[model samples]
Target: MTAITGALAMAVAMGLGRFFYTPVLPAMMTGLGLGPAEAGWIASANYVGYLLGAVLAAYGWAEGIERKVAISGLVATALLLLAMGVSSNVLVLAIIRFLAGLASAFVMVFTSAIVLSHGLAASKPWVQSSHFGGVGAGITISAAMFGLIILADSGWRTAWIMAAVLAFAGLAVVMRYLPRDIVRTGPARKEPPLAWTPSLAALTIAYGIFGFGYIVTATFLVAIVRVGGGSSLFEAGVWLATGIAAAPSVAYWMPAVRRVGHANVFALGCLVEAIGVAASVLVPLPAGPVIGGILLGGTFIMVTAFGLQLGRQLANESPRRALALMTAAFGTGQILGPVVAGYLADWSGSYTWASLAAAAGLLASGAIVLIYCRPRAA
Candidate 1:
């Protein structure tokens, strides 16, 4: 029950809050007459909010205000999603997305922290990694829901309404299962700020590279497929495949990491994802996106889970601060990815160069991790 509940929270906050935007992007472009640049800017707005929320969480604001903000974020996000159904103004949409991004980050960081403390007390640390599958599950459910809406001939507005309904359902589960009393792992250890460690600085920069590498395809894959003349069902199926592949990635990769070491496995996942990201544009038709989605979905969460674990290992005194630093690095890259890709695509009349550039970034990051982040000899 605890694991299920944690997964549901992530499904709502990260999956629905963050990713539902991917499938819905094409609809909005068609319905709202939004250009690629406009859509990219809106997406970047969300990342900005995410960075702010994560910084607040890291600074210990979450320790006292988390419960209030958690509930408020869930409720507010639901209403904001519903509001999206009624508003077509670009400014309004951007504001709502930004706030929703902020709320989602709060739910993700604080709830995970809360759950981790409980899991630690219960001696069930594995639950921390396992619950991340919720992001994939949420992605699957949202993709299916959007697919059904399109099948019913509904527009972008109805899709937003469906997403809101799904968020509300998840909210009920969260309110019921999330621990009301905050659980403390132990006395907080004092450590220097995250910027002090050379190794951590490298890790932080690598994480940002990953964020840049993946965001382009993650944001625009559906649109790329649509422009390539794929059917709506095909596009949804690609996204669904990504979620399904993602759902079990951590389970599979964790064992590998245990054997080979975190740095090696992490770097390998980056290479795999780079190939997948490039495939979206390099290959053809349903085959391209489908293959790309599988690779993209399967490895991203593994990289994230491993990266955070590595951060905690490095900055044992204050894992939360490490997380904040990582989020800031990652969010900054994400902020840049879409906007740059959008402009590049607009200029080139193709996503080819942009996709290749993202892949190159991932490869470079993998190299950095291999050289700088490798685990020391026992």
Candidate 2:
């Protein structure tokens, strides 16, 4: 039940709250006459808030009240989605996205701590996979909703309204199933500080690079389809493919982790995702975006799961702090990806060069892991 609830929470917070923007971006662009540069600015605003939220979560301030913090995030997410629906001004939208990003980060940190800790205590590692699967599930749901809105000839505003309703429904499930008093009611104990090591530093760098590599396509895949003259339905289908591939990715890669170790698997996933990112702009329309979307969906989530798991292992004495540090690195990369990609798209009139650069970053990320973080033989 805890695992299921956690998945629902993630679906609401991450799938809808954060990533739903990707699917909705094209419609917003069409309706609002937004250029890539403006879109990038809005996306970067969210990432900025995410970076701040990660830093805050790293502190001990919210330790014992993680559940409450998570719930607050959910509430804020739902409201912000509604707020998005009502706003047309670029600055207002950016502010709302920024607040929403902050809320999503809070949900991510607290909910993962709750769910992963429970999974570890229960000796059921599958719980971790199921919990993360919520993100893919949520993405799938949003894609479906977007398709329905497209069928109705509704705009992005309607999509946001529907998203708010969905988030509220997920929030209700989490409130009912997730225990009210999961954490002890008292002052939180202080955790030992995370020790900086060469391996850990390399992993952090790799994780940040992975963030920059994946986000370019993640942010603009639907828009890219539009540029290729694909119908709205086809665009939604491509996103749906991504969600479908993502749903079971963590579970699918768990066996690989046992065989190759986390860092190696992480490296391999980066290589695979780099192929997908390159495909997005290199290959011709339809097939190219579809294949790229699949690869993106299939690897990004698994890599994310492994990266955080490796961070926890490396910072055994301070998992939460390590997660915060890694998340901050990732957020920093995320902030740069869209701005760079957006302006490049506006200038070059295509995503080819920007995407190729991102793929290079992924390749470098993989190399870093293989060189510096690979586990030694016993």
Per-candidate TM equals 0.96, 0.97
Give residue 134's lDDT in candidate 2 (0 to 100). 94
lDDT string for model 1 (229-336, tens) is 998888888898988998778888878887988888889999999999989999998788888899999998888878887877777777888987788888888889
Q: Which ten residues in a row have the lowest lDDT in candidate 1?
A: 187-196
Candidate 2 stretches greater than 4 Å from native: 181-187, 376-378
- What is residue 149's positional error in candidate 2, in angstroms? 1.0
Candidate 1's TM-score? 0.96
lDDT agreement of model 1 with the native:
0.84
Which residue pairs overlap in candidate 1's backbone?
none
Count of clashes in candidate 2: 0
Residue-by-residue lDDT tens digits, candidate 2, 1-378:
999999999999989998999999988998999999999999988888888899889988886788899999999999999999999999999999999989998999999988887788778999999999999999999999899999998988999999999999999999888755444334468678889988899989988998899889889999989988899999999999999999899999999999889988998999999999999888998899999999999999898889999888888888899998899888888899999999999999988888998899999998998888886310
Lowest-lDDT window of 10 residues in candidate 2? 179-188
